[model samples]
Target: MLIGALLILTWLILLIRYPAKALPVSGAALIGLLLVGAWMYWLDTREARQLAHLELRLDYAPTRCPADRPLALTLKNGGGSPLQELRWRIAAYAPGDSVNLVETLYDAPRYRGPGELLPGDTWHDCLPLPPFRPGYRPDTLEFRAERLQGSFAD
Candidate 1:
């Protein structure tokens, strides 16, 4: 879909650039379309895998301060190549309500972290949750991971 769209767009641009006397319509447009399509297609990595193998748990559901309330998430990569970035959307469900948060690796690239999802690789992240109250007995804490667009192989 991406390549096809680019090809059509390029052809349109080339048609506008060519002069009336140059050709019947636009020869340059045809060439431009092919070139752009090839470039975009070249970026597709066929061997890439798309899936999330994650293990989330309340490491320490303390009824105290944020530092003391420990929430850890372990992500394991069971794919062929390394994932560029892993974005996580975590939701915590308590007795009668729930709250969700988006977590991403932070360090180098834009919204990317130092962690790379390598084959058979595991990354452990410690999330700080709002301190749980003593009176509230949480029902369940659930989490889902969303891999960034360019992170997965084509």
Candidate 2:
């Protein structure tokens, strides 16, 4: 944005100072602004586009630990990039309830897999869930991928 503002300011100054060269200078500035806009759009949508190709499934394994129910996650990276970081949201809801009973956000700097999840790879692991209110049990749980940042491997 700063670069775009500077380009516009520079174009305006050139137009006022050198009327003869205004046309060519303004054309070049326009091209620079368009290039900046394209780069910004790509940066803004890259994460969302990658996230769309990811699939997540969540289940509870109560028998595995009688005290604290562990969450079982199966993530499939269908995108063309190697996933490095993930932040997701978990929401607990009662049956037929529109409002959520409880919600929590989890950030995993490194996912618990063999390594960075590669494209077309699936990772399955058990993770500890955040504690809910005492005696407040939810019937259904919802999962959403809040952020998925990754890069393509060379």
- Per-prediction CA RMSD (Å): 8.3, 4.5
Give the clashing residue pairs of candidate 1, or none: 48-153, 105-113
Worst 10 residues of 2 by lDDT: 105-114
Please list the residue runs of candidate 1 whose C-alpha ends up more than 4 Å from where it truly belongs after superposition: 1-27, 34-69, 91-114, 130-139, 147-154
Worst 10 residues of 1 by lDDT: 105-114
Query: Which one is best on lDDT?
Result: 2
What is candidate 1's local distance difference test score? 0.50
lDDT of model 1 at position 43: 55
Q: Please provide, for model 2 over 92-129, each residue's C-alpha lDDT reduced to its tens digit, 9 standing for 90 to 100.
A: 55556656554343542333333578889898776666
Q: Evaluated with TM-score, which candidate comes out highest?
A: 2
Relative to the true structure, how large is the alpha-carbon lDDT of every model?
Answer: 0.50, 0.66
Which regions of candidate 2 deviate over 4 angstroms? 1-14, 43-46, 65-69, 103-115, 131-135, 138-140, 152-154
